[model samples]
Target: MNDYAIEVRGLTKRYGQRTAVEELSFVVPRGSIVGLLGPNGAGKSTTLRAIVGLLRPSSGDSLIDGVPFSALDNPASHVGVHMDGFGFEAGISARRHLEICRLAAGAPRSRVDEVLEEVGLAADARRRVKTFSTGMAQRLGLATALVGSPRTLVLDEPANGLDPDGIRWLRRFLRAFAERGGTVLLSSHQLAELEQVVDEVVVIKQRALFAGRLGDLVTSDADSLEGKYFDLVGGASA
Candidate 1:
């Protein structure tokens, strides 16, 4: 198997006359959590969308475990992606939503309860999704992603609307996931939250700019990863 869980070579995306991502290239090593950072309109989301086959790339290509993403019969088994909301039916119970996703992903029914417990949602399994707070919903989304036990995870702004305790759980969960030999690629506007979890980071400013280890990116002069991020991305905040 390839050492890289994901590889993008000279990737580009265009919408009409505007270019979203231009000639982007990066590699996400297996069993590592990589943070994708950039300001608003920096094409972070577009790059992820292309990788997960949501939006076709305008140029170049991406692969998951050396297999082209498009060639996979069921890409979700290899890559679990959570973008935006959890997409659960409000009236449905949390457990029911998990069952539906389990069936759709062809995942084993036995994994459903395991994932729910992993995400700390076991106590609320019978609660309707409509009553879930934003943090609860986010945890539910994470549980769904874990149901298939994918080799790679792609999450966009997962920390949004989460409280401090929830963020702590998320960081711990992601760290544990990576330590177990799974690759995680996450994008978030909250650099502080990411600093606690990611092993490496890929920063794009209008396009690809910096890609390296988290420690190297956040040197003593930089003091913090977010500070380095601002400097690298032209001091622009999303």
Candidate 2:
């Protein structure tokens, strides 16, 4: 099998005269948890959208498992994506929502219950999505991504709504997923949580800045992911 789960080659996105990203390139190796870090307006979302085939890159390619996402068959089984919006219907039950996703992905009905349990949402499976807390909603999004049993996950702001305990749970869940040989490419503003869980970090601001193992990049007792990131980006807040 190919070693890289995702490969972005010279990715560029533009909005009329404004350039969102220019000549960005990165890779997410198989069986690793990689973090995509950047400040607001750094084109992180744009890059991710391109990777999942939601947008066509202006001047490059975004590949999944060695092929462009648009070229894959049964893509849901290979690359699961949870972008900014959860895309849940407010009135529908969580269980029903997942059932729909499963059906669309050609996944078995059994996955609905299996993924709900995996994401700790089985107890609230029948509740309406409008009634779910922000944290619960985040878990539901993750469940939606996992319902198809994909090998790679591309999540955006996955930790946004979680509380302290929920953050801990997410950390453990991501670690377990990597341990099981799944590749993860996630973008988040939560640097501390990211540092605890990611094996590799890709820091960017409108272009490729730093892309490598977190350990290799921060190789001193006094150094930290946050410090290194600030040094690279000049104290800009995410």
Candidate 3:
């Protein structure tokens, strides 16, 4: 088995004249939660999409457990992914949506209910996707990711619409997952909350500015994630 759950090596992507990312490299260890931090337009989303095979890199490559994402025998069984801007059919029930995903992933039908319960969506299982609030929808997305029983997860803004309790629940859930040998990579603007959960941090702005254990960024004063982030990336937004 590989020592790292994810490895992005000199990954680069370009769109005509625009460089989305350039020479970005990082590794996510097994059974650890790493926060991918960057300002807006930092190419965080692009890097993630390229790593998961949603977008091909113009140069370099990414691997999940030592194999390219496209080469995985059963991708969902190895890595779960949730990106924003994805929406379900307005009339589709959450349960039905999960069932469809489960089948497509070649997962057992029983996993649908298990993931629903795991994500706190069991009570809303029959609710139509359009009827769900942002928080509920986020939960549904997580359920979709979990149904495959993956060993790793890659999530973009998983806490966007969650309430305080929901955020706390997610923190606990991730900790428990990692304790059980599951790896997680999450990208979020919520620095304070991120500081509480992540074991490592990867900061970028088009390219990798910093990547190391969280403790490395925290100085003698115990700088906060937000403070250290701004300090490293500077006051600029992009």
The better-scoring model by lDDT among 2 and 3 is 3
Candidate 1 lDDT score relative to the true structure: 0.87
Q: In candidate 2, which residue ranges exceed 4 Å CA deviation?
A: 235-238
lDDT, candidate 3, equals 0.92
What C-alpha RMSD separates each model from the true structure?
1.9, 1.7, 1.3
- Counting clashing residue pairs in each candidate, in order, gives 0, 0, 0
What is the lDDT of every predicted structure here?
0.87, 0.91, 0.92
TM-score each candidate. Answer: 0.94, 0.97, 0.97
Provide the lowest-lDDT 10-residue window in model 3: 218-227
lDDT of 2 by residue, 1-238 (tens): 6789999999999899988888999999999999999888999999999999998988989899999999999999998888785578999999999999999999998999999999999999999999999899999999989988999999999988899999999999988998998999999988877888999999888887899999998899888888898898885432
* Candidate 1 lDDT trough over 10 residues, lowest sum: 229-238
Least well predicted 10-residue stretch by lDDT in candidate 2: 229-238
lDDT of 3 by residue, 1-238 (tens): 9889999999989999988888999999999999999988889999889878999999999999899999999999999998886678889999999999999899998999899989988888999999999999989989888888999999999999999999999999999999999999999999999999999999998789899999999765667889899998995445
- List clashing residue pairs in candidate 3: none
